[model samples]
Target: MKKVVLITGASSGLGKSIGEFLHEKGYTVYGTSRNPDKITDSVFRLLQLEVRDVESINNAVAKLLAAEGRIDVLVNNAGVGILGPLEEIPTDEIRNNFETNLFGPIEVMKAVLPQMRIQKSGLIINITSIAGYMGLPYRSVYSASKGALEYVTEALRMEVKPFGIEVTNVAPGEFATNIAAHRYHVRVSQASPYGAYAKTIEVINSQVGGGDDPALMGGAIYKIINTPKPNIHYKVGPFLSRFSIVLKRILPDKMYEKMLMNHYKL
Candidate 1:
């Protein structure tokens, strides 16, 4: 039987790329967006789902199972990006980022585990970030949120091993997407303490626009889905982006910190 795959936040960006790629490979693909009514051009079915809301998550899963009977793969790609100095970012924004980036994926996993356990096989790919591997200067919360999910993937994968469910994280460094436009950016002020943060934001947006194509992530996801035993962590992006993670492991803490500071020109 063709596998049934569900991807959250698939209205656009990397999520849409994955859905389209998997659909072409003959899988039954269902993607979710907060407002499905507005998304009409996707190759796969689009359902209404809000990661921040448990009711919306449960409802979307129920509708999928009722229609497809089994959900073999899930891509928890629903997340938000937050950019600003830690001290300047509002507490509520931090909480909201966790709600979408960390808690959201966990709840989706909870909703799917029962069915996956019954089927005796399933795969979950949580879209994290390379920044999660190391704390970025101004994007501390974004790093923390993605970093927390990485650990969640580590813990949940082991816990669900006996039930035949596989959970893993795929951290994408940067991709050519409209993510720059959607990020929760705290408006910079001329007199703010972290005035340099405005420059950091500009650098970030420039990199995002120049990042690897989303199709590359789609290709990477396809390979992971077909693997009999997927690793706990995978990353997709340009060479420098992926290499940065390796450097962090081998470089001294202060040296790595200096490199980051110099790169962001902080």
Candidate 2:
């Protein structure tokens, strides 16, 4: 039997790359986006979905189930990044970020788990970020969102293990995706006071360079999905993530904060 995979936020970036990679590997792929028309026909089956809306998510799954009968893999890749000081960010903006980044995946998983449980097999691959493990200067809310996702992925892994469903969280450091450019929310009012700090944020963005190639992340996701027994988490991108992991393990809380402040020049 051919494996069927459903990927969210598949209009572009890592999600689209994963969809294309999986399709090339001979899996029946269903890719979902807010604007399905934007998805290329060569990639996979494009389904209209808005992760922020529970109704849209449920409806998309219903349509997929009606057509394909089963989904073997669920890739929750739809997420938005909100970059700014925690105090400066709007309450509504924070809610919106959490809705799309955290709750969206949770709802989609809830919708799919019933069928997956009945089948006694499935894989849930969540595209988290390096920010999930460590905090950055201007990305407090975004980091928090991913941190919540990391925890959710951990909990879900244990919950679904008994049902023969595997959950994997792929944390990519940086990919050459428009996510940084497209998703950043800068509040000029809040930033005006921190003139030098605002300039530092720009420098950090320039250094990150939109991340590594999206294809690298695509390959990593492909490997995880294809593995006979996937691990709980797969970290991709440059060696910097490894360094951060080591630092996280070895450094004290205050010291770690100091180190990060120095490294980013924040």
Candidate 3:
């Protein structure tokens, strides 16, 4: 039987790329979007999924199982970006960010685990970011959300290992995607000292637009799922960006902060 795969936020970008690549390899791919009608991919079945909604998440999984009989792999790629100084970002906006980036995937994993446990085999991939490893200047909350998700992935691996379910966090540095368009850009007050760093926003956006191809991440995910045993964390992106992960691990906190601020020219 073809391995069944489910990917969230598959309307475009990395999620769509992953779904398309896996479908080409004969996996029965089911993808989710907030608006299924907007998913133009004919190669995979698309389902309407509002990740923040419990009913929507549970129903999507149920619908997929009804059609495919099993869900062999899940890529939790659904997430939103909130850009601004943490103090200036609205409370609701921060909550919504976590709701989508952190809680959403956890709930989805909860919904899928029973079947995965029953089968004694399954793979769960959580899409995080290099920013998660080190907090970015204006995108503090976005970093926090992804960082929290990484911790969740770490704890979850131990909990689910005995059941034969595997979990890994995929941290991508910069990728060309529509995510930049949807980012919640905060208007910094001129009087606030952080206002000077506002220009960094435009710089960040430019980097994202010129970043690595989404197909690279798709290819990485494909290899990850097929590996007999995968590492707990996989970082993908341009060489310098992926190398930052190692730098963050070895450098002192102050030195790392200096390097990060210098990179953004803050």
lDDT of 1 by residue, 1-266 (tens): 99999999999999999999999999999999999999879989999999999999999999999999999999999999999888988999999999999999999999999999999999999999999999999899999999999999999999999998888899998899989888898997888888898789889998998999898888899999999999989989988999999999999999999999999988
RMSD of each: 0.7, 1.7, 1.2
What lDDT does model 3 reach? 0.91
* Off by more than 4 A, model 2: 40-42
| Winner by lDDT between candidate 3 and candidate 2 | 3
lDDT of every predicted structure (CA atoms): 0.94, 0.85, 0.91
Displacement of the residue 67 alpha carbon in candidate 2, Å: 1.5
Assess every candidate by TM-score: 0.99, 0.94, 0.97
**Candidate 1 segments whose C-alpha is farther than 4 A from its true place:** none
Consecutive 10-residue window with the lowest summed lDDT within model 1: 188-197
Please say which candidate is ahead in lDDT: 1 or 3. 1
